[model samples]
Target: MKITFTFILLNLCIFISAQNDSINDKVISYDDKIILRLNLDTNVDDYVISSKELNIKPRLELNNQINTSFGLDYKIISATVSFAPHFFPGNNNNLKGKSSFTSYNFRFFPKNIIQTLSYKNSKGYYISNTQDFVSNWQKGKDPYLTFPNLRIQSFGGSTSYIFNKDFSLKAIYYQKEWQKKSSGSFIPSLNYEYLIFSDNQNSVKSREHQLNLSFDAGYYYNYVITKHINIAPFAFAGLGKKWSSYKSDVTKDEREKQNYFTQNFGAGIHLGYNSERLFFGSKFNYSGNHYDDNGSNILQNNFYVLLFFGYRLDPPSKVKKVYEKFQDKIPVL
Candidate 1:
């Protein structure tokens, strides 16, 4: 099933690439250069449960970890691999238990359209508000409630279109292009994901599967301060639907299915500097979503800061030859 889904998604992206239009002259293209980037970002996940009837709110979070990723961009395709290294200071906190995260992401830009696909896996989590549960819990000395066997895996993809030809999202994201002048765009996107949540606790195992779909309307503006510097800000809001199926080893009811409505919103800003061959950037973003789960409100929130430095190099002859060979068959290349 996974293989079939991936194949279909790839074909869909390829079909979308065929509909691409020409970019405006204000956007500088760097299709001939190969860009290598190093990125550092806080990759943390958090969940909050609130119950009005019980008059209590509890929060759960994964260990706060700094993730490092290596990215490569050549022509229309870009890819990144990310992992949480153990050598990072806060990643090894004993109070939060052990946690791990890994992700693989790819983006394809075909003129004015952008398509993205990603897979992420995370394990281990802990209740963050230990003092609320334990009256005498000492800070930094007491352990929080830990879910060492909890795991989450997701497969996701998104497709977006740039309505304004003068604006280049690639300038702010992948650095494959540069916007010569200030411009804004009303970009719209469709996102979909399949997620699995599983845990084994106290000898009882449970699992849940969810499929989600959302549509977002976003606006981004790139303000060119100078020839080598720019600032970009973006905001988006979306509504989604989630279909979930859950099962437990202790339940005789086999599987239970449920549907939920969700809403999400976020805003962010990026500051960047770009030269002939070197580029660096920093970004800060916050996002949150909420849904009703069995009469209780469940909310997920995320905030992260990212820093990246990248350098452009000339592609080798063999690499250029391979890309040229396939450019005719795959228009996205």
Candidate 2:
């Protein structure tokens, strides 16, 4: 009887081991697939504005941006780049307002560690009723001045560790620092500013410059909806310090140069479906950043929406070659 019992236990252990090995192999195959992604559609990038001195609360509104992105992915790494052009349909004579190279991110996953290198350009709307700021607004010719946009650019990298299949933590760092510029091409326009409040009303244009090094840590939880679908929700909050310089274009002089502390907090949700040969997802995020100087503050609430579809790129070459050979038979426009 003792020998029979020992034999049954040994067989059960072997069966469990085989099942675990099969699961690992399936996961590995999915991770190793090479995939291509196409962007379907998206809404205008929205921004919210607020101020302490103006008694105006923050509000979210769509901007005049049309954005598109292309991406490629594989087991070890993934890359994405986006271009956004500001457009106004009412003004047929007006040129495209500005072409913003939105974001570039390269992400890598090696076992439990996830690494990311990213560059981002963000825009925020500003509204003020103060006499000083309004005076500057009335003098400007750029239409963007009435709804001023703050352009902030940053290049940074982040690292994260997976504690388990359901949980992870991430930390971000920026070596170069975040900087602010006007809403134009790489080289700003002469009188492109929408608002400028200073001692001299002769402020032909103005640009706000910021130098900030920030750090943030966040937690993400992956909630499984099905074998192929999952939703990951995350939350984060951070603090940093920045040196700001407000510059007047004509005089080439700095109006206000000061250092202040800033705080940011946000949360987002990500939904995705994954298989061995295909992956697709969509994400929506909302964040608010604020900094105060004297009696006024620069506050921004930002929202991001992205949709992506990816499939394994291993197309049949023989079939493609046959189709290409007979392409001349098809009618052309």
Each prediction's total of clashing residue pairs, residues at least 3 apart in sequence or on different chains, is 0, 1
Q: Tell me model 2's lDDT, rounded to 2 decimals.
A: 0.48
lDDT for each residue of candidate 2 in 97-147, tens digit (9 for 90 to 100): 332337787765544445565666655433323334444544234333232
Pairs in clash, predicted candidate 2: 145-194
Off by over 4 Å in 2: 1-31, 40-52, 56-62, 85-101, 121-152, 165-205, 250-255, 314-333
User: Candidate 1's residue-wise lDDT over 51-89, tens digit each?
Assistant: 868766788877856999999998777899999997899
lDDT for 145 (candidate 1): 84
Q: What C-alpha lDDT, on a 0 to 100 scale, does residue 214 get in candidate 2?
A: 47
**Candidate 2: TM-score?**
0.58
After superposing candidate 1, which stretches have Cα over 4 Å from the reference?
Answer: 1-21, 328-332
